[model samples]
Target chain A: MKISARNKLDGEIEAVDLGAVMASIKIKVEDPGVLTALITKESAEGLGLKKGDKVSAIIKSTEIIVGKE
Target chain B: MKISARNKLDGEIEAVDLGAVMASIKIKVEDPGVLTALITKESAEGLGLKKGDKVSAIIKSTEIIVGKE
Candidate 1:
């Protein structure tokens, strides 16, 4: 299925750390190294996310912050 | 300020499209092709963003989604 989010990074799961409410996922991508994603524990479990699984990190343009330094 | 967001892509502003309520910013990064950011029109005006300006795209892990196909 097609998604609206512009940033779709394909990578393999490096690790998964589940917390009480949230779950942290580490994805290893070739272009940008490691990308971290945090989602609800329920959502994580629903997707059956695990280490070494191939997945894509999807981010919308609105969620991204433009920082000037 | 040190942000907890792990994905920070430093890039130059390529374009800016301002709407009545929101604004779309296009940033060109070296590693990735281009990153798009959507922010409120007020925030865009407050930041005085313009083309050729150097900036970083900041995104929190929670705002990202993981998809498998």
Candidate 2:
């Protein structure tokens, strides 16, 4: 399905760490190097994510913050 | 100051479209081509954002989602 979120990065899953409520997954992308995603444990299990699994980190424009250097 | 968000993309503000409540800002980055950020009108004005302004698009890891093809 198509999404409205502007950012969608494809990469291989480097690691997955699940906690009581949240799960931390690391994805290694070519352009931005690596991106870390903190998602719900239920969502992680629902997606059947594992090491070496190819996935995309999806982010919405509304969730992004603009910062000045 | 530093933030916990893992994704911090440096870019230049290409344009800013402010509405009554929300604002849509376009940022041109080197790696990801161009990114669109939906920020509040208050934040857009508070930061004094304008076209050609150098800025960074910051995103929290928790706000990211994992999508598989």
Candidate 3:
């Protein structure tokens, strides 16, 4: 899919926790970190996401506040 | 700052484009991908964010739809 957002991290599925209305997906990207995504239960099932699957964390937000200290 | 979101990509500021009310911040992660963040101009200035500065791309969404094929 063509997305305007430029960040695309290559990672593997680490965990999948599905709730009634929401689901949390943990993607283990390189650099020794994990990217967690929260989505709807329906969407999670639709994607057939599971542990050891490869997926991209598609993040498109207009409120990505930048910080410096 | 304490956020519920678990995805925090550590990166360095690659670019900062400021407009009247909004600003676009680009961050280069270690995995050879760039993360783009769109925030308010006020927030951008308030954080004193600029190129070469290190910041985390904080993504917290309740609708991070996952896709697989």
Against the true structure, candidate 2 reaches a TM-score of 0.84
Off by over 4 Å in 1: none
Docking class of 3: medium
* A-chain TM-score of every model: 0.87, 0.87, 0.85
- The residue pairs found clashing in candidate 2 are none
What is the per-residue lDDT of model 1 for residues B1-69, given as tens digits with 9 covering 90 to 100?
Answer: 686787877789999999999999999876557879999989888999999999988889889899987
Q: Model 1 Cα displacement at B23 (Å)?
A: 1.2
What lDDT score is found at residue B12 in candidate 1?
A: 94
- Give the top-scoring candidate (DockQ): 2
What lDDT does the true structure give each of the candidates? 0.87, 0.87, 0.77
lDDT of 3 at B8: 71
Cα misplacement distance, residue A25 of candidate 1 (Å): 0.2
Clashing pairs in 1: none
In the order shown, the candidates' Cα RMSDs to the true structure are 2.1, 2.0, 1.8
Best by TM-score: 3
Give per-residue lDDT, candidate 3, residue B34: 85
Q: Which ten residues in a row have the lowest lDDT in candidate 1 chain A?
A: A1-10
Candidate 1, A4-51: lDDT as tens digits: 787766789999999999999998876567889999999889999999
Single out the weakest 10-residue window by summed lDDT for candidate 2 chain B.
B1-10
Whole-structure CA lDDT of model 2: 0.87
lDDT of 1 at B39: 96
